[model samples]
Target: MKPIFDEPEQYQSAVAKTAEALISKFGKLADGKAWEAARMPNLTRSERAYCEAVAVRVTRLVRGGSVPA
Candidate 1:
């Protein structure tokens, strides 16, 4: 699929930024699973919906496709 960014440089930068943010927020991707586990119980229905939307956005952004692969 075509990249979401206009150029390779932009794509690399976007990936780097995503990685950096993930690292900052959760130390590493492993922590992401932990975070998800910790967050599940406290989510209200509306909060859960918002989280699902954000997950879909992130998936599309990284996969460079609007629809799920």
Candidate 2:
């Protein structure tokens, strides 16, 4: 388990690997910058759509028994 905000080399490596795998499998995210854009406090319709899509995909993948990392 990683400590919060530790930013260890292993953690960075794992994040990069996971992102690569997800992008490769999903073929470019629909709202790649949604995370940062969502900090506006009032999300737009497209932002909501992007978040929902991401949640659904993640849930389906987890339910499918492919434990990420």
Candidate 3:
């Protein structure tokens, strides 16, 4: 598939920024698995939905297309 960014530089910057944000918020990516598995009963309905939406967006961007081999 075509790249999301027009050039490699833009793609690299986007990747770095996203990685830094994720790491800052959650230490390592493996921690995310445990976090997802953990309970969160305190969240209201809207908050839960918003969290789910953000998770979906992050998942898509992380797992989406790649540089051609």
Candidate number achieving the greatest TM-score relative to the actual structure: 3
- Which regions of candidate 3 fall more than 4 Å away from where they truly are? 1-20, 23-39, 65-69
TM-score, one value per model: 0.41, 0.35, 0.43
Model 1 agreement with the true structure over 18-65: per-residue lDDT tens digits:
544554565434234434633698887755544444444444444455
**Model 1 poorest ten-residue lDDT run:** 26-35
On lDDT, who's better, 1 or 2? 1
- Model 2, 1-69: lDDT tens digits are 655226556654544454445546654351343233344568777555445444444444434535344
Model 3: per-residue lDDT, tens digit, 1-69? 765345666655554555446646665462364236233778767555444444444454455634232
Q: Which portions of model 1 show Cα errors greater than 4 Å?
A: 1-39, 67-69
**Model 2 Cα displacement at 40 (Å)?**
9.7
- Arrange candidates, best lDDT first: 1, 3, 2
Weakest 10 consecutive residues, lDDT, candidate 3?
30-39
Clashing pairs in 1: none
What residue pairs clash in candidate 2, if any at all?
Answer: none
